[model samples]
Target: MTNSRGGKRERLASAAARVLHEQGVEKTTLADIARAADVPVGNVYYYFKTKDQLVEAAIDAQDSDLRTMIEALEAMPDPRERLKTMVGGWVDQRDLAARYGCPTGTLAAELDKRADGLDERIGAVIRTFLDWMERQFKEMGRDDARELAVALLAAYQGISVLTNALRDPELMVMEGRRLTAWLDTL
Candidate 1:
């Protein structure tokens, strides 16, 4: 039901996103999501039959947010500026990244061991960014655009790991600046 908080379904999806980002798939329960969303735990079953369905809702929410951000980033005509700005955006999330690590990276790492196709579902979140970064590199006339894309994400995820391990948001900012400079050379 819609109220001052918006649709319950939407709130649940948002809660799933936040909880999943902070807590990982295995650690996060439907009850946890329901509580975070301020909905009755039983009501969750009315909207999503299973936890996987709820996780999928969270993935959908991430995809939608990513699309909106990507769309805005695409408005920049220059590919290099687009990428640099993207790094700056990551820098903006230094605190969160430092605290929880890269949300997509952590999710992928946790889901990777699972037998179900959820791994690939969460993986597409990274792949989506990879594809966009690849396009940007391609526009820069790089012969190995895909390779650069992989390298870029790899560096970001690596930095995120270090950021969390060291409990230093400044590390991400430092790496973000370095990545932006590296992008300039590409």
Candidate 2:
């Protein structure tokens, strides 16, 4: 419902996304999201019937953010430059990734263990990105666009895990530069 502060559902979903990313799905509670959103815990039920539903909303929130980012990148004139900037943007998150691992990756890994279909929803987010990357590669006339997209995203995710394990943001930066350089040659 709309309030003086804005839509409570949106706020709760946003807060749930942040809390879920920071705390992981198992560790996050609806009350925690309500607290973060500054909404009464009871009010959360009006928006989400259960924590799983809230998690689903948070997943949608994450998807929305990713789609928005893709839209921004779509504005770039060059597909190659768009790809480079995407890597750069990810590299910029190295510090946070080091602290909590990649947000999308963390959520996907954590949620995959669930019996419900939440994991598939999160997987769709990754596929969304992969599809976007593949489109960009295809735009650049790469016949192996899908494979290249997978390789690039896989590399980024691998470095994200290592960056967190090693607590070294530089690892992500170095890999980003390396990936961008490799992109320049294509």
Candidate 3:
């Protein structure tokens, strides 16, 4: 594809991701994404043939972001600090989480309920985070690393749900502090 075409596709994918996080898959329309991307609605078809394809592209974008975040966390010498940094990153996005919940969690929950074939795709998005967390815990020499990873991710998702439902960004910040303190203990 040409540079312009690639740029338009990337823009559409980004807009779709934002819309998906805000309105969810059930409510987000192609036109909504197109408008947000400032691309012609008809031109969206040139990039993605179907809404599912567009949604998949959004998921892929999010997955790429998760990979990037993990890569950054890898720079921390200590695994515990890396985990804490992950929590801090979430805290940094507290406002957005309060408004939309977690982009990956919300998408996974919504897609899971749909019973679509996209479950594996959505699972990969979450697995990337969980796997990284597990690796960190394992590096810390914890036998229950897998369990710890699950607990941490669950805590994040649970807090995110409350934050969004209660419209309180501080809830996430408080949770992040608590998680950090908990990490220090382990």
TM-score of each: 0.93, 0.96, 0.97
Cα RMSDs of all predictions?
1.9, 1.4, 1.0
The Cα RMSD in angstroms, rounded to one decimal, for candidate 1 relative to the true structure is: 1.9
Order by lDDT, highest first: 3, 2, 1
lDDT (Cα, tens digit) per residue for candidate 2, span 1-186: 258444888899899999998998888888899999999999899888999999998999999999999999999999999999999998999999898888889899999888589999999999999999999999999999999999999999999999999999999999999999999999
Candidate 1 lDDT, 48-107, residue by residue in tens: 999999988998888888889999999999999999998999999999988899877887
Judging by TM-score against the true structure, name the best candidate: 3
Candidate closer to the true structure by lDDT (higher is better), 1 or 2:
2
Residue 96 CA displacement from its true place in model 2, Å: 0.8
Clashing pairs for model 1 are none
Where model 1 places Cα greater than 4 Å from the true spot, the runs are 1-6
Of 2 and 3, the candidate ahead on TM-score is 3
Query: Please, what's the RMSD in Å of model 2?
Result: 1.4
